[model samples]
Target: MFKKLLLVVFIAAISCTKNDGFQPNGDVLSIIPLEKCENGFAGEYPCNDYDLLDYISLEEIGGIGTKGNDCWGWTDPLDNKEYALMGTNKGITFIDITNPTEVVILGTLATRTVNSSWRDVKVHNTVAYVVSEAADHGMQIFNLEKLRNVTNPPVVFESDYDYTGFGSAHNIVINKTKDYVYPVGTTRSGTYKGGPLFINIEDPANPIDEGGFINYSHDAQVVTYNGPDTEHQGKEILIGSNEVEVVIVDITDKSNPIKLSAISYSNVEYTHQGWFTEDFKYFILGDELDELRKGLNTRTIVFDFTDLDNPVHHFDYSGSSAAVDHNGYVKGNTYYLANYTAGVRMLDISNIENKTITEVGYFDTYPDNDMAAFNGVWNVYPYFPSGNIIVSDINSGFFVIRKSGS
Candidate 1:
């Protein structure tokens, strides 16, 4: 999914030993003091309105040498315990963050294939499906319920099931309402040409291939439509972030999908990732290389999807820092963003209709510099009901933070 493959390749070659100082283990490090942003610094890192509850280094979760990539969160419905499903070069790490201060690294599910810098995890019905760019890394399905009984820490777990329909995928999109999973960024020559591969995961373990779209998609968000567009209400839709454009596909009927629309914007560098607002009225996108290519601060583009067929660019939001934006998720009126090098930034989107978005809070895990680079927070999971934000850092591992007074 990286547009500058050679840039990442060069960085990977020279940065593989970035974690040489640390050692690998499943031990929980000491908790970070509850400190608020004071004069732009939260204790040692830069922050605003947010406080860090805990921080775990890569060595504590999996080991040294390996690095973190993408992350997602799961709250066990039965006990209401929150867990962070973090991705590392090793595999998916299950961390018990119910007690943020005493966070525990329960265990890790080894990658089915080899190690790759890119990996993504998404959960549906107590199961998590993970995919990586590693060759032949196919999606690894794990019963998240297994984390409940992780008494012995640091154990190596195996995937409960593995789907080999496609060799490698950059990301996995889940439409929980329809019990379907779409694996995007697959092999370009596959049946779908790296587009959305529809898989029925109603049977979490046994995924049946429904169909897929042939247009290559780098990342996508699939949901049962119920937005401002009344005509397409209740239909299953896929909003894809193709390299050059944002594609809207109606996947209500998997057998016969429809390409509703495809749109691009100015100064396009790479259509990397995006998410729909809670109401599904606006789609926010982040171009992976635009900050570097355009020499602009962190830029976010919003699209008005009231009429999916004739969607228009609503506005562009530029952050104060020049960090590269990765993945972002919206909850209610807040947009939690994983800003590479700039760390995780929380923006208030309540005034989005007025073309206004204000940064409310942030925790800079990577305080080195907020330049346009891919060496910091990879992604953030803000959907956790506990109000605890899970941030996966490319260098520092994982962090759990909350609003200062929340």
Candidate 2:
């Protein structure tokens, strides 16, 4: 989330329909044949050991502006079919990726308000919640099961529930372990000062507003604390990337949530987003602006959380490119990173505790130069049961990818 107030203002000034002279190629629905990573290249896309399952362009998905920000995956509890929820400037797109070769564009749900270049979506118990930076764009909750009843393909879908309790959120966090959803980076000057909103979504349609943290958070990952920290093992822990520092809080009791601790790293530009290892002993963080501001190759910091109250920076892993790291998620021992200009990179964190991380594979959706700019894959969804990867790009629209020979 490179969403500082200055850039948000500049983007909201423009219009989604206003053409900036960028035209897409794939206007009709079509499927791309599987291209395996051979001799360092998959079709025209550069890669190591990752293969391109399929690709859908912005024009094909009826995208007006070349702006996509976040992505999430939803697996139907009814049939275990995997679906990709891609957040665009105008709305959130739903695609049926059960069959990577024959991908289906379910449709798009228009934003709660006008377009503003940033949208985030997350899934919890058959419901998908979406948020955007557009003014008055409240959290949109859509029924995931409805995807099975679209009579016409690619229609302009609508949300099942619209919660306007708060306006314009940057990202949505859900700890499925409990019946609550956290919306962080909301409208500033609110009671919580743009911190995480603790809303009880026990009834997906009727989300009740509970109390929340009172600090601005760019992005965060909240867990039920089943990690190594036995002191607060069962508490609701939220690790927020709050601009300059990472803040940890105990939200098990929303009425009086406690701040466990906060830590900052060196050469910090902007503390963007982070994910905990499988063990939760280590946290992997990304600095969104360090590559461009500090001229550093895609930097990723690893923090030792053996002591949650006093976290320490263990080491930093530099990617092969100078592109910015947008969003990353850990699926088992592999770290799936959405490198802004370099596309999606997979890192082997099996030995991360020993300060040893390796680049396992990559699939470059942006074939252009890997610069430290924000014009490539925005997010990646790798938690699907089918082992497929769903990637959302700013210039391109949708993509389905997977590791070679997987």
Candidate 3:
């Protein structure tokens, strides 16, 4: 009773406290492709099988007091050049990381308003869409193809277009198959009450805000359904990470989105974010307050999403650290997790059907302690074609890592 009441009353006060950079240069922190993790330590950062390719500090990117938030990757189809699109407290930063040995800072775009601790970025086709918790900070769209035109090192870039459909969003998800961007966690007192604002981004620069879902969503993932569910196949589905429960909605029809189902677990602290397996059979979720409130190690929840109308809890996997688990993503048979203090953990989900999962490797960016505090890696991107992973730390800034001796 006390835990629930305290969470209801005290969480609102604590969640509003936001405090909040980028640096690029070989001078800050740089390790080449040879820092092997033989003795479980890559340079000074702890690791297992991943080596530190490059590191960019907050000071080098003009983010002295700001912290890193979220990140996404973009590969130029015209030339196959990979770039890292990262978010900070103040703005969004872009870096050309094709050459891991000599990572170049392409540029950065300032926030639409004041600096806020929460900022998120996503990409579709050739454009990047950015959103944040800053007041009146509308969505900032940038044409990513311009990166090839940047001859200088790191310059300040501006948004090609800004969509003012909503303000102060926490995150954004893109359904690439349909060219729609859903901006969620907007103002609580607004029309949709913090749900996802359905905006068509087919044109990239000019966005059309049609409508939104009628509930709150902290983060979400939308995809064209090709799962085992035959009835809902070929439709656009949205799995939302609500504060308490996971809500599945059929968003194929933008004007009339139908809620398929909602599910909650045994100990629901705060459903921060989750990701579907590559096969779209299971959903792995991370609750932000589970470690802090329950006094447990990193606990990851998995759910079988075979039937969209009735999802069931699969199993729970406990990590090897007391650090809090935040954002997580699955690529192929591996799960890339961003742990606040434990850094990024790589879990092998090849045998997920048997309810078995294992942590294959880990790279600890914060070696001090593995508490549930929020001072370590904020996000990780593993979709680069060259296998170079992007790690954005809240304190350490940006990093590019790859498999040792690969």
TM-score of each: 0.91, 0.91, 0.91
Steric clash pairs (candidate 1): 24-63
Q: Give lDDT tens digits, candidate 1, residues 236-312.
A: 99999999999999999999999999899999999999999989999999999999988999999999998999999
lDDT tens digits, residue span 356-402, model 3: 99999998888788998998999999987667899999988888888
Count of backbone clashes for each model? 1, 0, 6
Q: After superposition, how far is residue 83 of candidate 2 from its true place, in Å?
A: 0.8
List RMSD in Å for every model shown: 10.2, 10.8, 11.6
* Candidate 2, run of 10 with poorest lDDT: 1-10
Q: Go through the candidates in order and give each one's C-alpha lDDT.
A: 0.85, 0.86, 0.86
Mark the regions of model 3 whose C-alpha exceeds 4 Å error after superposition.
Answer: 1-34
TM-score of 1: 0.91
